[model samples]
Target: MSGKVVDDRDQLLGEAVGLRQAGKREEARERLVALSARFPQDAEIAYQTAWVHDTLGLEAEAVPYYERALAGSGLSDDDRRGALLGLGSTYRVLGRYEEAVATLGDAAARFPEDGALKTFLAMALYNTGRAHDAMEILLTLLAATSKAPEIAGYRPAIEEYAKDLDATV
Candidate 1:
């Protein structure tokens, strides 16, 4: 790609993210759409476009961008985690529970240090009627992060999950 197109894409993406953060969801989606059209190979733009669609409750529109981002190479670990989690969350929200479970399970395996992914996977498992497995995952995550700051951050939800798990099992 030319330097000019790259620069334009970067500027558009930055503006789109700022617009989304400022509660201008429609404007952000427009900018993201334009960016996606202009730079189809840009993974970050595709991912952000997917996010804008997600925030607007347009899961169907987001799926294409997410798939494009997933097909791209050279993503950082955080971006990979974000894409995986976003896809999983979207699938979960759309009632594709099995897909969410499988995707989040893969993400949890890849990002074992990410407490949030583990919690998300646990939720997917629980919601998919695998409460026992969810409980086991939560217990394992808590045990593993017992001394980390992440444990404290996830403690409240994790504890509530534990109670629900116990009730289910």
Candidate 2:
């Protein structure tokens, strides 16, 4: 952060983000890499670097950077949420289902209102052969969030079924 004003650092981050959004993923990754070096303690930069690696299909390389970002406390609230989801999703993609479930479960507990986190956690739970648990989460989420007329009308039933799939007829 020394020798760089907050706005300058943010501008660099914005540039990297723009590159990623522009589909110049390699360039974004490069810019984030450099920014990470320049701001070694910057959680957001590390998180961005990790995300770029993930988008590039380099999940393995992204792990340490994600971990580094999460270990630091400099991330804003949204970025912290993203880091948790990113790391957990990366673990799932890497076939580390147990780790994914653990990480995503923690993230979901921390951000109960985050539907995305719950969705990913469901996937991880399924990967670990917790299909019933996964279905429960999915069903509850759907009941709570779906706007389809049919589902909307049956929200209470869906929620009840989500709690006990084996209920009597």
Candidate 3:
């Protein structure tokens, strides 16, 4: 990436993402701020900036930017999905369980193939006292991912939740 032209928007985004991954959050944020200034119409920059804020535990500051990203005219399906999930997570962290459930449920319907979406929805459901629904979703995920070796990564939590749900029933 060193020889690549940083002047390009996507390259800048890549660099920012790389910086974020390298734990240079301040630098990443600076890059995003510069990108936001340079391209006010670029929803991706706003979205990434909001994500950085969210990672820094600034949900209140992130919400408007996520809203802006959602409203931005030319976003692709992936960006739309990211914005939806980010907004839902922010709402969840803010104790808006109903909104989180509604937002994540909509995202799950829109992107049924996204395992992370299902997991997130399950978490929200479980936290909101809908453990049965959470268990059902987790069971479905386990079935779908049975062939993958890393299913074990999520199994314990799923089993614990399932037991809790069973006790509730």
Candidate 4:
């Protein structure tokens, strides 16, 4: 790409991000949508567009953009993680449990230290009738969280989740 084009893309992305941070999600999405069309091959643009849609409760609309972002080769690790997590969560919201399980499982494997990914993976597993596996992951996450003094506040919520999952099983 030309330097000018890159600069323009960066400026547009910054504007969209600024809008989002300003609580103008609709405006951010609109700008991102236009940017996505202008830079169809840009994974960051696709990811940001999808994220705005997802944050706006338009999961169905987010799905295709997330897919495009994931399929693109230019995504950074963090961008890929966001796309995967968003796509998996959107699939879950759409009741595509199998897809959610597969997507979240893959994401969890790629980012094992991310407790939120594991939590979502557990939920997807549970929804897919793999409750035992889900419970195990949650339990492991809880165990890990309990060992961290800095995150002690999360322990209660983790324990409650464990209790709820155990009750279901």
Which number leads on lDDT?
A: 2
In model 2, the Cα lDDT at residue 126 comes to 97
Model 4 per-residue lDDT tens digits across residues 1-169: 8999899999999999899889999999999999999999888999999999999999999999999999888899988988999999899989999999999999999998989889999999898998988997887787676666756756766666665665643
Output the lDDT of residue 169, model 4.
Answer: 33
Q: Candidate 2's residue-wise lDDT over 1-169, tens digit each?
A: 4556788999999999999999999999999999999888889899999999999999999999999999987889899999999999999999999999999999999999999999999999999999999999999999999999999999999999999998987
After superposition, which runs of candidate 2 have C-alpha atoms over 4 Å from their true positions? Answer: 3-8
Error of 3 at 116 (Å): 0.5
Clashes of 4: 0
TM-score of every candidate relative to the true structure = 0.82, 0.94, 0.74, 0.86
How displaced is residue 9 in candidate 4, in Å? Answer: 0.7
Can you give the lDDT of residue 129 in candidate 4? 93
TM-score of candidate 2 to 2 decimals: 0.94
lDDT minimum window of 10 residues, candidate 2: 1-10
lDDT of predicted model 4: 0.89
RMSD of each: 5.0, 1.4, 5.9, 4.6
Please, what are the lDDT tens digits per residue for candidate 3 over residues 1-169? 2344335888888999889889888788788878877777778888988888787788987887787787787678998899889998898888888888998999999999998888888888988998889888888788567766577676766566555555653
Which 10 successive residues of model 4 have the least lDDT summed?
A: 160-169
In candidate 4, stretches whose alpha carbon ends up further than 4 angstroms from where it belongs are: 147-169
Q: Specify the highest-TM-score model's number.
A: 2
Q: Predictions ranked by lDDT, top down?
A: 2, 4, 1, 3
